[model samples]
Target: MPPSNRPIHARPQAMRNFRNEMRSATMSELTMPVAASPGRLDEAIAAFSRAIGPEHVHTDDATLAEFSDPYSPSSWDDYRPPVVLQPATVEEIQAIVRIANEYTVSLWTNSQGRNNAYGGSSPRMPGTVVVNLRRMNRVLEVNDELGYVVVEPGVSFNDLYAYVREHGHDVWIDVPDLGWGSVLGNTMDHGFGYTRYGDHAAAQCGMEVVLANGELLRTGLGALGAGDGWHVSKRGFGPSADGIFMQSNFGIVTKIGLWVMRRPDFYIYGFITVPQPDDIAALVEALRPLLLDGTIPNQPEVFNDFAALAEGAKKADVWPNPGRVPAEVLDGFRKKSGAGAWNLRFALYGREEIVDVNLAAVRSAIAHIPGSTVNGQKLRGDDREAIEALGQPGQVQAGVPSMSFLSVMDWVGAKKPGHVCLSSIAPLRGADVLKIRDIVRDACAEYGYDYGTGITLSPRHLTHISTLFYDAEDPVAVRSAYDFCREVIVKAREAGFAEYRAHIDFMDHVADQFDWNNHALLRFNETLKDALDPNGILAPGKSGIWPKRLRVK
Candidate 1:
C-alpha cells in the first residue's frame, strides 16, 4: 500500500515568527534593481515622481508588501519590488518607460494587481520597479451597435459591468471567477470566462501599447488616425503585433478593445451530475458531440465532489484526517449534499425557442450515462434582479461577475490561505480529460494533499485547472506546495501536455518544456526582446523570456 499520509498542521508560534521576520526585512531595506546604481535609481524615482506626482511614487514598506505576491511559494523577498509607480495616462506610462530605460532599471507592469494565483502584482524578478496602471482606469468607448468596449488597463470587470449596466446597454461582459481584476490585464494574460465569448484573448480586437523605448503604437485598425473600425477590425494591414505583447515583456498595454456579447432574449442555466468517479469519462464523451455541433453555447465546467465541497466549506470541517481524504468519506459527503462524484455546470443563451431546442439536445446527449441527472432554470436576460440572485456560478455564466469563488482559497481554513494554480490544456476528449485528471490527482495524493481541481471544457479543448492551496504563513507547507506543482508540471509535460499559463515561480520551467528543435521558440522570443527592449528594462523575466543581458551565455 501507499505510505500513510500525515497531516501538515499549522504551528502558530512558527507563523508568528515568520511574519515578524518578513515585517522587519521589508521595513529595513529597499531592494534596488540588480544592475542599477544608487544614484541612477534615485534619479529614476525622482523622474517618476515628477511625471506622475510624488503621491503616486511609492517606496514605503507597507505599500511594497501590499504589492508583493501573497501566494508565492517562496519568500516575498524573492519577488517584491523596491518601488511602485502608478501612472494615470498613456503619456505617463511612456514617461515611466523612458525613465526606466535611461536609468537601466527594469519594470514589471500590472493593472489592478489582483491576479493572485499567478503572482498578483509581483515582478518575476525581484529588485525590479513595478509600473501599476491602476490610476489609468477609464472606459473610453462603448459601442452598442458593434458589440465592443474600449478600455484602459485600469478598468476592472466590476467597473466595466457597472458601466454597461449603469448606461443601460444591451450588451454583457464575460468575466472570470473574480470580478475585481483588470479587464485588459486578464485579456492580455489570455484568461477565460464561462460565456460564449469565454475566449478572452480571441475576443480582443485592438491594443494601445507603450513599447520599451517609450514609443506608442496602436495595433490593428487603431493604426489609422481617427479610424472608425479600430475596435471592430481585428486585423488591419499585414502583421498582427497584438499577440507579441500578450504575456510578454515586449510592451506595456495601455488600452484594449474587447468584444462583448449582446444580451440574448433569454438564457438557460443547467447542471448535470454523474454518480461514479470515473463517470466523468462518459460525461465528457456525451457532451463532446453537442459541443462540436454548437448545441451548447458556453464552456462547461466539470468538478469533482471535493472541488464542489471546497467552494463552500473548509477541509477540516469535512475531513479532519490529513493527507488525501478517504474515498468513502468523499462519497459520504457527496451523498449528504445530494451531489454526485462528478458534477457538470453550463449555460445556453438565445431566444426561448432556441434555448429550449438546445436544452433538449443537451439532455438527450447525456441521457446515456447511468445514474445521471440534469436540472436547471431558464431566466429572462432583462431580469437583472433574477440574474443576480442566481449567485456566483450562475451569474458569471450570464455575464455577471462575483468574488464568491475566492472562497476556495480559504478552504484550508488558514488565516493566511493561498494557492498556486497549474492549468494545462488538453484535447476535448474523455480519455484526455481522464489522463490529465489521474496524473494531477495521483500527484496530489502522493504529496499528502487532497485532489482539489476541475476541468473547463471548451468546444475543441479543455483546460485542466489544479489548485494547490496551502497556509501562506507556513514555510514548510508553502515549499511542499511549490515542489508538488513543479513535479506536476514535469509529469504533465512527459505525458505530452503543457500549461497554458503558470505562476511566476514555474514560468521558466513551463517555458523550458516547450522545447521544440532545441528551444527555437525561446530563441525567437529572445530576439524580439533584444530588438524591442535593447536595454532589457521592461519585465525582464516575464513568461521566461529574459533579455540577452540577463541570460547566461
Candidate 2:
C-alpha cells in the first residue's frame, strides 16, 4: 500500500517504448525547430537555460519522450508535440513566453500533466513547446485563520495535503477522485470537489498569470500591488480578471491562491439510491427542500449504472456488500451496478448534532418518495483510521475509490482500432444530467458501441456538471466515438448546455457550441492573440479559439 508500490508509474510497454523513442528524437533535434529558425531556437533555449539553469533544461531522450506524446487513448501521431521546456520561476516562464512570441514558436502550457480523461495536458499542434510547470511546485502560504493557501500551478493535491498535515494545520484537502492531480489545474479546468469545499473555482481567491506577451497580471486583491501578487482574497474593485485566463490559452498561470476548509468537529459520508429511472425526477424534486433548507450540506451525486461499476477497478478480495439499508439501487442500474435507488453518493459536514438532524431530514424526504430508501454509515474515530496510514498507496482509507478512469485512460489501449474519450459539461440539474446521459447512451447504442459515463457533482455550486465517456479503440470506433461526442455537444448547445472543459484535440470542434456573434469573450481571445502573439506563437491551434491559418486560393 505504500507510495512506491502503486502501479501509477507502471505505464504500458508500448507507451514506454514510444516515449523512449520520442525522447531520443527530441534530443537529436534539440537545436532545430521543425519550422523555426535555428538561431531563434538556440537563442530561445539559451535564454531559458539562463533563466532556470541548464540542469532543468532537459533534452535527454528520457524526459523528451515523456513530453512528446500525451496519455490520450488515440494514436501517438494524432497529438504528439516535439519538445518540452520546464521553467522554475515566474520570471523564467515570462521570458520563455516572450521568446515564443518573438520567434513565432508554438508553446503549450501544462500543470502536472494530470489533466487526464480530456487530454487537456496535450499540445494540439505538432512540434510545439510544452511548458511543464511541475518544478514550480510550492505551497507558498497557508493562512490557518483565513483558511486560504497560495500555491504555484505545479502544486498537486497530494503535495498540498501533505504540507498542511505535516505543518500541524487543522484543515483537510478537498481531494477529487484522483489525489495526484494538480490543484491549480483542476480549479482552472473547473473540476468538482466531493466535500463542502467542492466548488474549488469559487474557493480560489486570486492568481498571478504570465500572459503570452511576458506581462504579469494579478487579478482580485493581488492587483492592488504591482509586484505584490499573492493576496488570497476573492474580490477587489473593478471587473474580476481571473475568469478570462481560465479554460483558455490566452495566458499562462505561474502561481495560484485557493481557499481551503478549516477543520470542523464532525462530518458524514454516505449514499442514497432510488430504484426506478423514471423516479429520478421525483427524487430531484424531493432534494430541492433539503438543498434549500441546508439539510444536505455536501454535494450529492446521482450516478447511472455503468458509471458506478466503472468507478472501481477489477480486484480480488472485496468488502462484503452491506445489506440494503433503506431502499434498493435504482432500476436501469440493475443491468449495470445491480443493487438497489439508482444510487446517490452524498455526505454531511458541520456540527455532530446538526449532522444527525440533517441525516434525519434526508431520511424523511426520501421516505416520502415512492420506493426510495436511504442507507448510509457515519464515520467515527477508527472508521477513518486508515486516512493517516502513510507509506503505500491503499494504506490511507481516503474513502475514495483508488481506481479512476482518469488515471488509466492512456493505459486502456486499443486492441484493434483506437479509442478516444470526450468529456462534456452541463449546468447542474437532475433533468439535464439524465437527458444528456440518455442521449449519449442512445447514440452509442445506435453505433453498436458500448458507452459509459461518470458523474462528478460540484459541491458548492449545483450548476456545474461533468460527464466522462468511454468506448472501444478502433479507427471506426474512434471516429464514431468522436462523432457521437460531437453530436451530443451540438445537441447540448441546442438544449441550453455548454461544456466547462474539453479535450485539447477537440477544442476547435467544441468551440462551435458558443455562438460567435454573442461570444464576445472568445472574440477578445482572438483579438488578444493577434496583439500579444502576433505570429500565432503560443499554442497556435490550441483551444480552437485562434483564427484559421491562411492558405493558397
Candidate 3:
C-alpha cells in the first residue's frame, strides 16, 4: 500500500491508523543488527524486558514514533531504532547493557530525546535498540552553598529550574533557548545556554557513566567513594576522563554534576541594534573588547534582521516571494517593527553599582557604530513579576527556562516546519565573522533559500548558527536543505572553519574534516572505542568513530 498523502503533522484518525499499520508491518520485517540473528534479537528484547519490566520496554508504533527524528532531512525510517528500552535505575541500565553485550545487539542512548535539530532520539545506526533514560529523571542533590546540582540523565532544564524555585534555592540554571531538553544530555552534547554558565560542558564538574561491559565508573571527585566534594570539584587526583565522554560513543553518561549561577543582587537585560546589515561586523568588533575585559559576563547573541523577524513572523506572510526576500522588504518590515538590520541581546549580573559600571562600559564600547542604539531594563533578582514581564528573550538570558523560541521553526510557514542548524566556530573578530557570514549567505543564495543566521559571542570565539528552514512534508525541500547544509559546511571548512557539532547524517562528514596528522584524533578515538566496547554493542558510527568490526577497512 502507498503511504498517506496527508502532511506529517496533520495526522487524522485515518493517518494514525495508516501509521499503525506501517509500524506493524515494519516490526514484522524488522532488520536485526549485523552481529545478531532474529533469535538473538528476540532473546535480547526478552532479557531487557526481564531486567526492567515489560511495561518499560516499548515496541509499539506510538512509543517508537516518539523516538524518531521529526526534523530529519531524510526519512525518519532511515534512522529509526527497532526497539526502545526505558530503565529507571542504574542497576537496570547495567543489566540492559550486559544483555545487549551478551546478545551482541548494538544500543543507542538518549536522555529526554529532545535534541531535535541534531537528530533527536534517533540512532546513527539503524536497528540499534535505544536505551532512553527519561525514567531516571532525578534531582539527586541541590547544594545552595556551593551553587551546584547533581542530576540524572533525564532531568531537564525545566525540572531543575522548578526544583530550585520550589526549594527556594538561590542558584539559577543556565538554560538554552528551548528548555524542554535534558540538562545532562545538553551538557554531554556540549550544548550551551545564555548565562555566565552558558558553556554547559565547562560548567559540568563530574559524571557517572555505565560502560559497554556494564561497569559503573565515576569521573572527577566522584571516583572517590566518599562522594565528598563530588559536585563541587572538577578534577580528581588523576587525568580528567569527563571530557572524553562528551560527544563520544565510549560510554553512557547516567548522571552529571553541573555548576549553577548564584542569583545576582541585580540583573540588567540589554539590547543593541544597528541600522545597516554590514553593521554586524562593527557590532561584533565593538562587543569583543567588552567580553574580553569581563564587562559582559554572559554570552550575547546577535541576530540578522531576518532571524529577528523569524522569531515573530512567517516568511510567506511577509514576502511571499519565490526566492530570497528583498532587502527593501526586510528593511520596511524592520522599520515597521521598530527593529534594526542587526539586533544583539545581552545580560549583566552583579551588584547594582558594578552592573551599572558594566552597562556604561558596554554602551561606551558600541557608541561609535553609526545609527546604533541601546536600551534595556533593570530588575532585582527576587522580582519574579518583573522577570516574567521581561518576556522570552530577556527571560532566557536571565537564566529562566522557556520554550518560546520554538516558534522560530514556524517561520517557513509549513504545516510541518523544520530546521537544521549548521554551526561553525570562529575567532571573535569582525573580519572572521563577516567571512563566515558571507560563506553561509552565498551558499543559501546558491541553493535558492533564504538566509537565516545568528552569531553568538563567547569570550574568545563566535558561534555562527545558520539555519536551513524547510517544509518537512516536502521531500524536495528537505533534500535541498540538506544539500545546502553540506555545501555550507565545505565552504566553511575551506575558509578555515569547522562545525562544533552536526546532525547524525553529517556527523561522519564533519568528523572527516578533522584530518590533522592523518586523522590521528579519529584513530585515537577508535582505539578507545575498541578497548571499551569490544563487541561493538554501543553506538557505532557516532562522531565517525566506528568500532574495529564496523571499520570500513
Candidate 4:
C-alpha cells in the first residue's frame, strides 16, 4: 500500500518548531548507546523491505508524524516512531518480531491505525517499530453456527457490521458509536459498548498472539486448532493467556475470536435524569440491587450533570443545537429537583415480561433517590433528523457514547492537547463511590478547575474513576490538571483503592500504590517479559508492565 495521506491541517509554526525541538532531543537520547544499540535503522528498514517489500516500510519524518499521535483533540504530546512497518500477514508479523528481537528494538502494534485518546496509533514507547496493522485487516472467518468471528487485528467494527449485515445473519455486532476502532484493539483495551455485549473484554473468547520471541500462540479452543481454526468453543483449556496480552505490551495480538450477540426481542435505551449533587449516594444505593442481580445486565455508568449535558450538546448542529432540557421538564424528577443536569443511562433486556419486571424494580429503586426520575428519551429522535444533523460540522460523536466530559473532546480543535487521566478503582459500594467522587471533585475545585469526570461500574461491583480533559495549550491549566489528578490518585491510594487505568507518565506512581513485596502479578509480568523480549525491547516504558530497564523504577 502507498503511504497514508498526511493530515491536511498543520500546527502553527511556533508549535511545529517546539515539536521539532522535542523530536531532536528525543533523537539525541535514542542515539545514546545503552550498552550497544541495535543494527542501524537502515538495516532494520531493509529487513522490513525483505519481509513485505520496501514500500511497506516508512522512516520519513512526515510519515512518522502521521502515526505519532492519537487523534485525541485534547492531547498535545506526539510519539514519533523511528520506523513504521505495515505487514499484511501473520508470517510477516512474526518476521518483524523476529527482526526486532534480533536488533533489540521495540515494536508497537496498532489496529486500523486509529488509537484516539490513549495514544491512538502512536507507539506507547517511543522509537518502537510502530507496527501499523491496517494492511493485515481482514475478517479471517465468521462462524455463524458457533456464534463467533475470527478477525485480524486490523479488522474494524465497521468491517464486522458490514460483513454480518451482508451475510444476512441475525447476529448483532456490538459497536461503539465511532465505528472506526479495531475490534481487537478495543477489546484488548477494555473498551465498553452499549449493547448486551457491552463489555468488549467479555466478548473476546480467544486470540492469536505473536509473543515477544516471534512465536505464535492461540488460546481457548483455538489452542486445539483443535478442530476448525474458524470455530473456538472452549473458553480455555489451561490458564488463560488471552487476558495477559490485553492492556499489557507483552505481545502483539494479530488476530482475535469474539462472541457476537443475537438480537433480542426487547431493547430500551434512555436515561434517568437527576439534578442535585448530593443525591448521588442515594442513586448508588438504588443501583445496587439491579446490578447485583444482573437485572441491569451490562455495565451502566453514571454521568453527573455536567457530563450528561455535554454529551447531548456536543453535536450542536443538530436540531436541538444545545440539547438542554428545560428546568421545568425535570419537575417531579427526584422530588422537585432543579435542573442540575445529570442523567443515568440504562437498558433492560430479556422477554417483555422479564423486562417489565425489571423496569418496575428500577422504578421502585428510583423512588428511593430524592431527586431522580426515569425520563423520556432525549437521545432518541427520528432517523432522518439524526442523520441530517450528523452532516453538520462539530456535531459528530466519535467512538462510544459516554456521560464522561471526555465525550466532548472534539470541541478542542485540531491540535490535540496532552492530558493525563488518573483513574482509581474502588468497590462499587455506594459509600466508597461517593467518597471518591467527592474527593476528586473537591481536588479539582481546589485547583480552580472544573472537574471533567466519568464513572464506570463493573458487574462485580468495581467502579472505574475517570478524570479527563485539560487544556494542554495553557501550561498552567495543564499543570493544575496533572497535579490535581496526581492528588486524587494519591488520595485514592491512601484510602486503599487501587488504580484501574493509567497513562505512561503515571504508571510508576500507580505501581507505587501496590505492594512491591508480594505483588504476584508484577513479578509474573517481569518473568514473562524476560522469557519473551529478553533484551527489553518491545514498548519499553508502557504502563511499567514490562521492559526490565523501565521496571527498575
Candidate 5:
C-alpha cells in the first residue's frame, strides 16, 4: 500500500495500532547499560507506574522503540529509553521525578518530540525513560488584546493556529518550518522561524518548570503567584532565570507564555534574486542597513539556487543524477526560480499605505545589483487560496503553517530516508556566507553527499543549517552521514564558528568548540547543574554539560 494520504496532522493508522500492541521487556532482552540492578529497575518501573498509572508506563520494546530518534544515524539501541512515561499534570511529573531520584534512574523529557533534527524525542542516555507530554496539551489562554498565548508543552503550532482562526482572533504566531512540532519545545531549543518574532526564545515571556528535585518553580514574573501576570511582565525583577532553562536540563518547562503579533492589514512577500554568486555579499550589505533601521522588521532568509529549487519541489526536477547538480543544469533551475545565484526571501507587515512605502524602499535598497530581479506579492492572510498559492516556506512567513518542507525528505531519501542537521551561527556578511557555503559543499562532496544547505538571517547574524540525508536501512550509509556531519562541524569550528545546535551524538563535539578562557562556559553550566541537580540524574550528557559524577572526561 502507498503511504497514507492523511494530512500531516493526522496520526498514521499503523502507529495507532502499534501503540496498542506492547509487552514489557524482561531482564534478558535489555541491551544498553543500566546502572541499577534488574530487580531495582523493576521496582523503579513499578514506582513510576504508581505515579502516572500502569497504563501510561510503557516498558515494551515495540513502544520503547517508537520513542527513539527516528533519524538517528547510529543504532537506535544506543539512545533508546528503557520505558516510556506519560504524565498529564505537574503533580504527576513531580512524583515521577521523585521516583527517579529514589532509584537513581534517568528520565528524558520531550514535549511533542516532533523536532526531527537534533535527535527528536530520544534521550541522551539509553537507561532513561522518555516522558512524552503529548497528552498534557492545552491552550490555557489566548489574550487577543495583549497579543500573547499561554500554552502547555503539548500544544503544537497547528493547534494554536487553529484556535486563533476558529475564534477569529486578529493575531498571528511566528512558526518554524515544521508546523507539527511543539511550540514550547521549538522555542526551548531556540529554534528559528521566518518573521519578526522568528527568534523564538526571545519571544518567550514566562515559564513554569518542574525541577529535577520534584520542586515546582516559575521563571521571570512567573515566580510571583506561580506565574501570575506572566504575560504582562516577560522580564521580572532581578536577574532573569528564563535563559538558564533553555536547551538545558535544569528543569522541565510545563507551560510558557509566547508573544503573538497583531494581524497586519497588508502582508507583503518580497524577494531579490541576484544572478552572480559573488553578488551575495553586495546583497547582504544592502539589506543590513534596512534591517538595522527597521525598514524590514522580519528575519530575512537567503537561499542558494539549490535550496530555492529543491525545497518543496518535485523529486524529478533535479534528480536521477546525484552529488550536486551540474552548473548548467543548476542554471536551468535558476531560470525557473527567477533567482540568480542567490535568493533573499522576506516579508513586510503593516497597513496598506506603510507596505506600499516599504516596497519602494526595498527596491531602492537592492537597486545596485546589476542582474538582480526584485518581485513583490500581497499576501492576504485571511484568504486561504491566496496563502496556499504562496507555497511552503513562504506560507510559514505569512504565519500560515504547513509541513511542505517534508517534500525535501521525500525527494532526497533513497530507499531508507532520513536526515541529520548541523547548524552554526555566523556574522551576517555576504562574503562569510559564500565562504561557509564552499566549506559545507566541499565537505559534503568529500562524503559523496548532496549539500542541502540554507542560511536563515537575523538582524546582525545568520544561521547556516545543512541537512545530510542517508539510507536508514543501510548501516554503512548511516555511519557515513554521521561522519559527514562531524566533518562539517570540525571545519566550521576551525574557521572560528560554533554550532548553534547539534545532534545527540555530537553534542559533545559542538560544546568542545567553545574553548575560550579554558572552556569557562561549560564550567559555569556545571556549577549550576551541581547546585540545582545534586543527584546528577537530569539528562546527564545533554549539550555535553554533565553534572559532577558523570563529567569524568
Candidate 6:
C-alpha cells in the first residue's frame, strides 16, 4: 500500500508553520516499526486469508477506504492498514491469534466499528491488520429469568434489542447515544448510557477472552470448573480478572455477559430548562441528591444549548457557516426549540405512586432556581408512545437503544460529516460544571468553533463529554477541530480535570498525562502488556499500552 501524510487544505501559511512548530515541540510522531520486508507482510496477509478465507480477508482499495475513519483529524492513510480480517467464531479467533504471533503481525480489534466520534474502526497506528468481528454477530442467550444476556463482540445494541423483543422478553438493555456500536465493544470501552444499568462497565459480569498466545480463558465465576451463575456472579471464589480486560489490549474479547434491566412499571421523562449560564451550579446541586439518594435511579443528562441544537435544532437550522454562534443567537435557538440554556433530562422508574413522590422531591429541589420551567410526559410500560419512543435517541437513558442519535452528525454538514469527542470526569459539585463549561467555551472560541457540552450524573460524579464537529470534505475544518480539541485536553488537565477517553490520533498524548509518581499507571499497564503479549501481535498501540517488541519511538 502507498503511504500518505495528513490531508491538507488551503489555510494561512503562518498558521501551518505555527502548528508544525508546536507539534514538533510538544507531540512528535511515534513509530510502529514497519515489517522487515514487503514479503513478510504479504506472507502474513496470505496466511490470515488461509486461516479464515480468501473472501474474509479484505485488502481492496474500496475496502481500505471503507475501513478508514472519514471523520478523524488526519488523512485516512495515517490509520490505514494493509488488510482487514473477519473471524466468525472463538476457534477462528484463536487460530488467527496463533498465526499473528507466528508472523509478529499486529492486530487491532474493533467490534461494530460504529464509534464514529472517537475514531471509527481505525487503528491507533498504521499497518496493523484490522480484526473486525462484525460476522460473529449472535445473541448466545437472553435469560429473562436470570436478567442477563450473553453476546459476542459483534452483537450490536440494535441486535440485542431486536432479539429480546422478538423473543417476547420483558427486558431492556442500556445503550449509548448511538446504538449501532457493539454491546461487548461499548462495555469494554467504558462507554456511557443513561439508566440504572447506564454505567456499562458496572453492568458487565463475565467475559470470554482470547489471549495473545492462542489461549482461551474466562473471567469472573466462569473461572471455576463448574458454575451455573457465570452471568450473574461478578466475583469468583478467587481473583476476578474482568476489570483488567476492559479498555486494555492484553487480549481479544470474544463474549461478554450483560445485565439488562427488567421492564419498569412506570416511566417519567422530562427536562428542566434553566435560562441562565450560571444556573448549571443550581442544577447540579438539585440533581446530585436525587441521584445519590436513589430518587431518580437512572442516568440523568444536563445538556447545554449546543447539544440541543445539534440534536433537535441542528447546525443547518441555524448557522450554515463554521464558527461559534453568538450568545444571543444561541439563546434564541434554545428558546424557539424549547431547549433552554441548560436542559436537565431526568427519568424516574418504579411504581406509579413512588415515581410521583420522587418527582415531587425533584420538583422541590429545583423550585428555588429562577427562570426554570419543568416539562415532561409520563408513560406506562404498556403505553403505545413509550413503545414508539424506543426508537428515539434519549430513550437509551431509559434502558432502550436507538440509532437516532446519529442525526447529530448531520448538524454541521451531514454529507460525510465527522466529529471528535473528549470525555472528562468532573466533581459532583455545582461549581465544577461551571468550571467545565467555561474551560470548553473558551477553548472553542479560540478556534471559532461551537462549544458543545453534556454533563451526565453518575451516582457520585459527573462525566462531561465535550464534542468538536467538522466536515470530512473540508481539510482545514478537520485539522482545526483536531488541533483545538488537543489544546482543550491540555487546558482541562491543567485545571485538574482529565479526559476519560479520546480519539485514536490523540491516545498517546492523553496517556502521557497520568504522570502521578512518574507515570506509574502506564508503566504498570506496559508490564502487563509485555507479559501477556510478548510477541506484540494484538492491538500494540491501543489506549497507549504498547508491547515491548512493538513499542513506538
For model 6, the stretches where C-alpha displacement exceeds 4 angstroms are 1-32, 35-37, 73-75, 312-317, 320-322, 390-394
lDDT of each: 0.83, 0.60, 0.83, 0.61, 0.77, 0.78
Q: Candidate 3: RMSD over Cα atoms?
A: 7.0
Pairs clashing within candidate 6: 194-397, 309-314
Model 3, range 1-553, lDDT digits (tens) per residue? 1122111111122233544555545432433246436678898999889999999999998788789777853354766777989999999989988998888888889999888888888877766788899999989999888988899999998998899889888988899998999999898888999999999999999899999999999998888889478878888998999999999999999999999889998899999999987888898888888898878989899888889878868888988877788888888888898888888899999899999988888889888998899986889988877887888889988788998889898788887787888999999999999899999888777777778788889988999998888887777776667666777888899999989988876676678778787778988888899899999888777777777765533
lDDT (tens digit, per residue) of candidate 5 on 55-141: 999988778767887775335476677788999999999998898788877777889986586888887765667888888899999
On TM-score, the stronger of 2 and 4 is 4
Ten contiguous residues minimizing lDDT sum, candidate 3: 1-10
Q: Candidate 5, which segments miss by more than 4 Å at Cα?
A: 1-37, 73-75, 226-228, 313-317, 380-385
Whose lDDT is higher: candidate 2's or candidate 5's?
A: 5
TM-score head-to-head 4 vs 6, winner: 6
User: What's model 2's overall lDDT?
Assistant: 0.60
Better of 1 and 4 by lDDT: 1
Of the candidates numbered 2 and 6, which has the greater lDDT value? 6
Task: For residues 465-534, write the lDDT of model 2, one tens digit per residue.
Answer: 3333333333343444555666777766777766666766456556646655665655666776666556
Ranking by lDDT: 1, 3, 6, 5, 4, 2
Write down the TM-score of every candidate.
0.93, 0.79, 0.93, 0.80, 0.90, 0.92
lDDT of candidate 6 over 1-553, digit per residue (tens): 1112321111122224544644434122333345323576788888888888889999898787777786853354667777888889898899889988877788889888766777788777667788999999999998878788999999988888788878888877787777788999888888878778888889999899999999999888788768578899898877778988988899999999988888788878867889888999898888888788899898888888878777744675677655677787887787687777888877888889988888888888889999898765677865635655655634776666776777777777556778888788888888887787788888777778777888888767898888787777677777667677778888889888888877777676677676786678888888898899988778866777777765522
